[model samples]
Target chain A: MKTFFTTGKGICIVGIGIGITAALLQKLGNPPNMGVCVACFVRDITGALGFHRAGVVQYIRPEIIGFVLGAFASALISKEYRPRTGSAPIVRFLLGFFAMIGALVFLGCPWRALLRLAGGDGNALLGLAGLVLGIGIGLYFIKSGFNLGRSQKTYFSVGLVMPVIAVGLLLLLITRPELKTGALFLSTKGPGALHAPLLISLAAGLLIGFFAQKTRFCTMGAVRDAMLIRDFHLMKGVIGLLAGAFLTNLIVQQFNPGFTGQPAAHSVHFWNFAGMLLAGLAFALAGGCPGRQLFMSGEGDGDAAVFVCGMVAGAAFAHNFAIAASPKGIGPLTPLFVGIGLVTCVVIGFTMRKKI
Target chain B: MMPDRIDARGLSCPQPVVMTRNKMDTSKSCSFEVLVDSGAARDNICRMATGMGWDVQVTEDADECILVLSKK
Candidate 1:
């Protein structure tokens, strides 16, 4: 069960498993295609922490916590836990920050983009296109000599930071402590209010975390590889995800296709494209997608830890600044933030190059 | 003649393979060497190059891998 399955077929199986699990989660009461949205869950966690006062978006999700702990356990079991750090960590943090901003602007991550498509949400097509373009731009930078530099071996304890935090969060979720400071918020009437059973969410997250870690499942990497090398191994995994999710959705009779009135999604085509463009570029720059970052953090990469923290912080900032989108439309400052994120990503892409 | 060398150390997976593919895309340069630091990169390059009708010979040197791809 805890084996490193990095082969093409192995990754495809993992993808299908993730897709089915996510569909089931949605049916069980997650926010639509948000069954496994890394970005949205991080955003919800920030709200629960009282980082932003978004009433309808506050909840400590067990799935997020499970993702970290599960990957940590998997890496430990597989003897692949390599505690390492020091490769432009600050840059990675900023990349993750902008990545969250972009995801919220689009109202989802690449995973959600795929899940949304599988759920028969037509808007996901634009987001997927934007993701491809974004990765393409990032690949251009990569081809023109961009590197995050090399990381060094670090002490074992350093890598355990994210897992410790995960455990702490899980405890908070379980205890549901009533702090005097009005923390540990939960939404009574929004996407944050909807969730699958705690055990189920946690189990699905654990399975996803374990498999993703073993296979190195990354949505951005899938698109990048397909485009850059004309190799479709990772792309096969993406196809598997879509197929699995679609099949599950059909079985549940939850397939609904249209541009308008999609759950937790907006019809603003421009922002959808630009938002994911920024997110995709950020993930590419950071060397992994959001889920991959969490998995790496579990395995003891301090840089990945920093990136994950940046994402959490960015979620807070997004909601606080009113830059995150809602079903109604784009946030007022979304264009500003998305534009800034795009420019920042481009600058990072251009400036962080090693001499070829 | 010394084969063209592309040092992909520190770059993530598929980048190594992508760069190697770029080199192969040019008809004039059929043989090249890639310096990658991870087993994943080495394996990916081997897998991709082998699929592209190129032979990959991997040699290890001090925390890095040298993947030499040749068409002839």
Candidate 2:
């Protein structure tokens, strides 16, 4: 039952599409080396909602909204929108929660890691190592029978929740409410303040979301499949991403290499590695990368919706508690937060397995 | 001889793979037949079983995917 999009070549096109879109977005005005960062954008959106007072990083990114809505549209069009829930929702939430903390520590998610590498950031090498190692640990658990149980089929409305939220957010973005009390929050400065043209960003998001849904493009899944089963089906997409981004960056002349002054990135090498490691483990446990989770939410997965909510809340906790990293360095409470996340993930991995 | 049967249909993701892993870890038999409805699940089981030094053969009809795995 494989369609044209499911083939290796097809998924490669999807990956290349995402790479080119992300690079193009950066060239268009998004942050350098950060065209479409899910975790970072989610944090910005969280800040924009006034969930946190991180002034430098608060804006309602249209790309995220478009991503969710686009995936929703694709799912509906393809008749693949199946509502599912009840697969340890709280644990899933916590996984997403810690995953965010981990990602923020590194200042990006898996896709951003690849993008950073394409932008010639040497720091991304360490982050990639951390991601691989973390996912490797999670693979150990998987080999030893780690599982979070199965999700049951739920109502159709359950699946529509995230998309509905996306629509509301789009409206809020359009209206541009002036409220000191609540509702919408926009950043006046910093990375959050920088963005590409709204319509173009949305268009890119929709295109990426549409093809990603069809091809099942997942960064974590690509790494996991490569490590665990040695199947390169999804890995091909990952390579396409790197190649596409690298070429685009070369064309745009944004390929600056060095660790001294990379944009929107810090050189705290240990934390960078540890952060992505924690994120990798969390993604492995949670069953998908952050963007994949968003796409799943679009496709009516209530479980993924819960995970997404957990991530949004995690962004708040990271900033409000001052645990997330900045360009200068790691936060004051980063070690404490990341330590707790690592131990918690290990406990979940061990305790949740179906032994015997 | 007959193989151990693992019906992983209706399950998603790591569950199917995890189920197969646990079964492979605990069972005495060297062969197994796993039933899965989703392509992801079927591929997961096939890969895990094959990686554990077993040969895997996959058969799919309209309803489900059948993975026949054996150690030789």
lDDT of 2 by residue, A274-323 (tens): 99999999999888999999988898888888889999999999999989
The DockQ score of candidate 1 comes to 0.34
Per-residue lDDT of candidate 1, residues A1-356 (tens digit): 11347677888999999999999999999998787899999999999989988899999888888888889998898666777789889999999999999999889999999999999899999898888898899989988888787778779899889999999998899899888998778899999999999999999988888878777788888888778777787777788888899999999987999999999999999989989999999998887889989998998889889999899889999999999999998888999999899999999998988754
Alpha-carbon shift of residue A64 in model 2 (angstroms):
1.5
Over all chains combined, what TM-score does candidate 1 have? 0.92
Taken over the whole model, the C-alpha lDDT of each candidate is: 0.86, 0.86
Top candidate when judged by TM-score against the true structure? 1
DockQ of 2: 0.35
Score residue A267 of candidate 2 by CA lDDT.
Answer: 98
Q: Give me the runs in candidate 2 sitting further than 4 Å from their true place.
A: B1-5, B18-39, B42-72
